[model samples]
Target: MMKESVQADASALDGPALFATMSSMRAMRRLKPDAVPDETLEQLIQAAVWGPSGGNMQCYEYVVVTDRDMMARLAPLWKRCVDSYLATTGKYAPAGMDEAAYGRMVAAIEYQRDHFAETPALIIPCYRFPEPRIDEEGLIASAQALGPAGTEHLMNTQTRFQALAEGSCVYPGVQNLLLAARGLGLAANITIWHLMLEQEWKETLGIPEDMRTFAAVPVGWPQGNFGPVRRRPVADVIHRDRW
Candidate 1:
């Protein structure tokens, strides 16, 4: 479909239509090699900015990569990350998934990995936190009251807290981008596989040294159809008033 057609169709989605779009979104790993227009990409980012951020700081930024040569450069890095993941976390089927289902998912990932250089565009969502303003004296006093063991535990978990704070601002926007892509008839999936070689990715893309990328979303026309996404039943996961 043409870019103009995509934009028009995306904009015309009503409330129910929007919900329908959200319900049908799937991680489309197998994508066509066709180019995505810059205008459509801009619309996706525009949708992303509409999402809220922590304290409304809006610190997120996007790197829209359309250059096939650059993708070729990053393809080896992508391979290393995918290889590591496949050998480790992705090696076995998860608890509820059957081996066949897991194998199919792995095949799609391998397909995307091998064709990394051919992806039409990759959108990387990045963020960098500003210098924090906090009362150091009060924090030190609280830590001291907690004693040595508590202080050590807090120190060890500090990095994790910082990462969660950063993700709180960036991931909402990433979800918006994904939803926008689905609405526009484009295939897109959010993946953090690049975090394995984040520093190299930053250097390659000219992202600032301090900025962190949260996801690498490959976007293009899909080779297959988009349909309903299967998930656990609503009742199976919900907590009414408390867990």
Candidate 2:
């Protein structure tokens, strides 16, 4: 249930102010170790559940970890994932990012990795899709309707398709959590390093065998400031009516 105080405060933001809160929301990787209150965390989760999910099923569940011992146990797994990412896809800065900026970003990532055990709180968002309900006859009919190429496409892409479908429902709630964090002056950022060792994480956190965890978000007071996020100009990316 949403706390009265939390709902009132969140609801008090005017449209422009809310947009400003979002505009300045940063991926705050360098976080202070100060404890966040339970009420504050509850407020964030309350904000999250308000987001819409497919069919209003609202199957998402959150695991909040504030125990230092639990974080310590998870730290080595985090290191392996971060190390793997750095060695491969994250080896260098992308085009247009200057080396200095990239270096700072990498340093922050390393800082977060090194200090993850000290995180004030971590939230793991999870969901398990209900079993697909197509009857055998309907399934056969659908397969026949698709013919060879479409059937092959379905076979090839089913896992990816379900992942996309599931993420569509979960990510909006995650975004709401981030935005609420920003509004409350708490720093939070979404990270998916847990996916690299997902089963291990699930076992350690005692998430159910059937659930799919999406993101590992660290929340705390920030060691740095939040400001406008850099992005390409709107004209460069927008296509009105058509591409």
Candidate 3:
């Protein structure tokens, strides 16, 4: 069941508002084996391309994988990574976790590992950079706007700031892609596990040497009812301007 908070939030939003649409941003795990139509997938990608890009560079590209052979080759690597993650994080430990929660995690991981090829569609998002170089002019402009001391502090954190800015641009496209899929009654998940087998994936997927994969997404129809998402209370994360 949807939580009271979620229902209230949904009710408070104006009909057709972006916030109401985004309220469905929960991770969907169980997917039916039915394939998403190619045309539908293309429409979703078209919507995703409308997302903002840093300096209008639009450095992103997406690769779709539907070949069973490729998915078969990639599944084992994901299994290993999933096992390692679960073990390291005590996902298998019986200490404080309830049996149902632990069992569900195990089952979900196993199902994903075993049935990845049946996902109907997979999308890999990649980013290409011209070359790795500091934006000196941008730095100078920011420094001039902020003055010497402020500039020094900003420059000290420039790398982190740049990464955050770039990721902000890219991740929204990912969200847009997912929402587009959901609007079509499809379920999907954005995964970083492909990073564990990045080299093999790049070789197999024909990813350009200059491009880097940022995320892998599996999309299909829902196999079961969607679960309510767990989250911290809005009061905990939201604050007035002073905060």
Candidate 4:
């Protein structure tokens, strides 16, 4: 009877414990260029594989690159893409900002613009399907799994919902990799710029034609201090039951 009661208490504690573990994982920036050891990286990969996948398909594939020559070769493409993003973003700059603040912001942007290749390691996550047609079936299965619906929605609506659900599975795997790195005293950030250059990057990395790149993550020990995260207030984001 005592053992049974203890087991019940342990089960009840699980949710809060999991939430606390997750909340403590802060996103880190300004990582040092020291390469993460091979064994440590394998542990992070193992953690990521445990993340949920649609139909347990485990469709994701990852390519880890630490080669100096390859990173140097790819650096120019990343710089060009980031520069373009910054140029476009500048059009939306706030009015009446002081010159000093504006200059600091531009400098920060420029630093990040050039730093991708300098990072110690880059991991590219990709997904592959047996065939392109399977994408449709996968979409349907993902949506129906969402929850009960009284009636079938339009195809467009279902597609959007399924994309969201599928994204949830893939991103958590990325998050697992990041958090596991943090626990091991490393820093990482997931970026999409490499995916933006998918064609060129795929050719350079020898990624198969069937694979689709999802994200690019740079990992290393931290070079600078972490700042507090800027976010909306908890009340703004949370609701008791429904909005």
lDDT of 3: 0.75
TM-score, per-candidate, Cα-based: 0.86, 0.88, 0.81, 0.73
Worst 10 residues of 2 by lDDT: 1-10
Candidate 1: count the clashes.
0
Say which candidate scores most in lDDT: 2
Error of 4 at 230 (Å): 2.8
lDDT of 1: 0.88
Residues 1-243 of candidate 3 have per-residue lDDT tens digits of 222233235452566755555666566667787777889999888978998888778999999887788877776777776677676763554554456756885787678767876778889888774454659897677778999998788869978986677687678899889888877778888878778778878988889887888888888888865444444457766788978
Q: What lDDT does the true structure give each of the candidates?
A: 0.88, 0.88, 0.75, 0.69
Query: Each candidate: RMSD to true structure?
Result: 7.3, 7.4, 4.1, 9.7
Q: Write the residue-wise lDDT of candidate 4 on 46-122 in tens digits.
A: 98998888777888888998888898888887887777767776634455454564566566556655776777888
Q: Rank the candidates by lDDT, best first.
A: 2, 1, 3, 4
Clashing residue pairs found in predicted model 2: none
Ranking by TM-score: 2, 1, 3, 4
Residue 177, candidate 1: C-alpha displacement in angstroms? 0.3
Best TM-score among the predictions, by candidate number: 2
Tens digits of lDDT, candidate 2, 197-221: 9999999999999999999999999
Q: TM-score for model 4?
A: 0.73
Residue-level lDDT of model 1, residues 163-210, one tens digit each, is 898999998888999999999999999899899999999999999998
Instruction: Give the Cα error of residue 185 in candidate 4, in Å.
Output: 1.2
